[model samples]
Target: MSGNLADGERAGAARPCLEIACDESGSDGENLTGGNTDVFAHASVSLSVTAAAAAVRETRDRIRSPAEEYKANHLLREKHRAVLEWLLATDGPIHGRARVHLMEKTYFVVDRAVSLLLDDPEGAVTLFREGRRTFGEEGWRAFLDAANRLLRVRPNGDPVEIFYGTADSLARAHPGTDAARILERLAATRPRAESYRAGCADGPPLIPVLNPLLPAIVRTAALWSGDGRPVTLVHDRQNMLTPDRIAWIEQTARRAGVGLAGVRLVVARDDARVQVADFLAGIARKIASDELNGRADPALTALLRPYVDPASVWGDARSRALLADPVAG
Candidate 1:
């Protein structure tokens, strides 16, 4: 299926905007660490808007799967290595090239943020839902302070253990306040910072998975839209792009001095370009996972390295360095 805007709309559209098709793997916002997958990945492939429609049709013609829809993981499992090699090849319909950013869940104290919020449920939930949204360390600190003020604790109870009794006490003590409202707000806001924390004594503070992913996507958009056209992003349907995450992406892009004309989420089966991105992202995810597990596949690495964008590999500088010099590290 085509991903480009229709002919009638092109005249009104921005002059030089780039259209990007993206896909992801191993993304579970709430269960980043507890889930089976540890690494969260987002991969984007960009193309000039002028070429997008044709490219989508052409790419779809190349798929050999019997299934009505195509997915990256499926191809990797069933097809010969050449199928992946061909997809990532320079001659493929993908015009702008592929870039991927991944975050390893273990590198940061993944559970600290959520656990902290859980401990001070009343305070944590209040700030998360009511406090002005912020990013990085500065934002997290402000949230914590705001949340602490809303809680009542004994001298020994640091976070004020929140339970049924605590809720009842809070409701009785503050007749005007709604304890149920607080609980509802907390449930809604918890996932916003589920993978983050104010501080982690064992490791660096948690960077929400989306923080890195959005920036990387924006950078790619900037590169593709250098000609003065706005950028439009299209991605496969996934949980990572929840309303809060989308807000975070736009906010983050603004902070980074980047612009996105539009962001579209579509089913992979309905969009050929996203299917192509899925294939590429799937390959990258597998390779990265293998490297992390110390089961590097030299043949596969050698085949795919030439297709990878040097700038948009995994997030860690060390991982990039290792990918560059696998034997040395």
Candidate 2:
């Protein structure tokens, strides 16, 4: 195992090599409202398997419990604060960077294709016109509400400009055109709109976990791929994420031109590195949930914020910049 890592590192001189351990929290998937966890967070750390295992082992020993199991949930207690502090400490021996993708489930329940709409200016205009005609002023208000939400929250670049420009152009072009006609035009020309129409029969297909998961992978890979070395990812196992999904992620990476060495799955208990990933994932979920509820714990926020890759963390300026990157597009 050490030899493999060494080989990877040496090869990385020509192309960087990154070993990633990943874990998730609040992953109830399509059944978001049915679960206690209202957010989904995919967290990862970039480090060799050996170093990450050592870090986890060292932290577990510091906790000083004879129990064989040590999970992120255990660290929520006051006594386990040291474990969190140690893992995120700059001088700590963890020897890696941490990044997480946070999805507020409620936002999705409100509108699953928010990102799609943001990218589809024509769709936004069509919805706005239809909404106004169907429910009078109230309907237009609601459509605008949803659209504004997407514009404000989406990581995509300069959404306000795109949204306003498209909407204003539509209003001017159609003038007093009938809402039904506008819908027909949108259905004919807007591929996303057409796709949604075709798929609506299936009840707006459940937003796959991979939607958020893939973005996280892309962002992380880009951040760590400074030297163009291959990135190898190992994610904590989930029954729902079958082999097909793994294959899809790999294929997507290939299409995106990401140098992916491999993708592996493992049980958290079997891999100490994955346990460290669990800790980061759990913390991210907590912070995102707290911010959503307007009850962010300052101390917890303070502890994790420094270690978090601001460019990858949702809602941060650095993350917005990443969103603007064509590669992410």
Candidate 3:
């Protein structure tokens, strides 16, 4: 595989390729607003097919279900708690080999609205960081709700109309408040809404704003390519990873100095590694969502801690504290 030279490598030397299997849980395509899941998780694992299959077999041996194939739900059952623990244990096959990127769906929509509509991404992030304090909890939720409606692309709706309508409603609802000020700032970027609408119309019809999978894939590639090796992702078949999107991912990663050789799509049932990745992604999503809702199982949360990527796009104070505190229950 070809990639940028690693430190201490000869300039023209070929870089080794690291093949990773990937799958995601809670993908609702661009429907992050009212999707079945509150969290989106993308997982990648650097394990050989044999190793992955062996792990799966081990899980099956412990669970002993009659199903032809196993899935994350099988492991997530209350009766299979020990099996789940064993899978996430440090000595487990997946421990150091897997990484998961989790995105809280609502937080993702808010981030997209801020980054797309505001001039300074950093400033937008800062505004969001202090959003709860600056605006009351109700006001902040109102702002997020507005942002979610504004960014959600509807087939028969005008983007500019949606943008102005949402902004006006939010401003009216929270007049003389920080939320209203943020809405004003967002309204100033009306042209961006028009441009985004035009781009979507001119393209293969993809939601750059609402889809978290695209960024998650790029992050996963970069994480696996840290050694300067080109990463070849063997992913489960996903409609969102179109040819144009894959090309975009590669180009974007290259610009960021990541060596993404390419991505290969395969059927999950046919790929054992991808199946293992599905388990990791699915389990991580469940644990994280539970934590966010204040119904966390301490044992499961502790087991899930290590697999979560540090760059996960979670905005909840509880999630932040859990990730930051090693001894957190």
Q: Choose the strongest candidate by lDDT.
A: 3
- Which candidate order results from sorting by lDDT in descending order? 3, 2, 1
lDDT of 3 at 176: 79
Off by over 4 Å in 2: 1-13, 108-111, 115-211, 311-329
Please provide, for model 1 over 1-329, each residue's C-alpha lDDT reduced to its tens digit, 9 standing for 90 to 100: 11345466766665555677887776544343345765656667765444544654544565555666556665476445566666666675552265555556433222233334455534433433332232334533333333332221211223223222333343344344443345343444443332332232245322342233555566555544554456778977765467666666666665666666767889887776676677667777778778667877777766555445454434245556655433210
Instruction: Summarize candidate 2's per-residue lDDT along 1-329 as a digit string, tens digits.
Output: 11134443564255445677788888654444445886677777766578878887787778877778776776666788877777766677642366666665544332343345334444443443354555466534433443333323222344344434444444554556554344334333345533444454455333352245655656555555544567888878776557776676677777878777777888888887788888888876776577556676767665555445544433233333322222321
Listed in order, each prediction's TM-score against the native is 0.56, 0.64, 0.86
lDDT of 3 by residue, 229-298 (tens): 7889999998888998999888888999988889899999999999999999999999998998889899
Model 1 spans > 4 angstroms off: 1-15, 48-63, 108-228, 240-244, 306-318, 324-329
* Candidate 2 residue 273 C-alpha distance from true site, Å: 0.7
Where does candidate 3 clash, by residue pair? none
RMSD of each predicted structure: 13.8, 9.2, 4.3
lDDT of 3: 0.80
The per-prediction tally of clashing pairs is: 1, 3, 0
Model with the higher lDDT, candidate 1 or 3 = 3
lDDT of 2 at 25: 82
> How far off is model 1, as Cα RMSD?
13.8
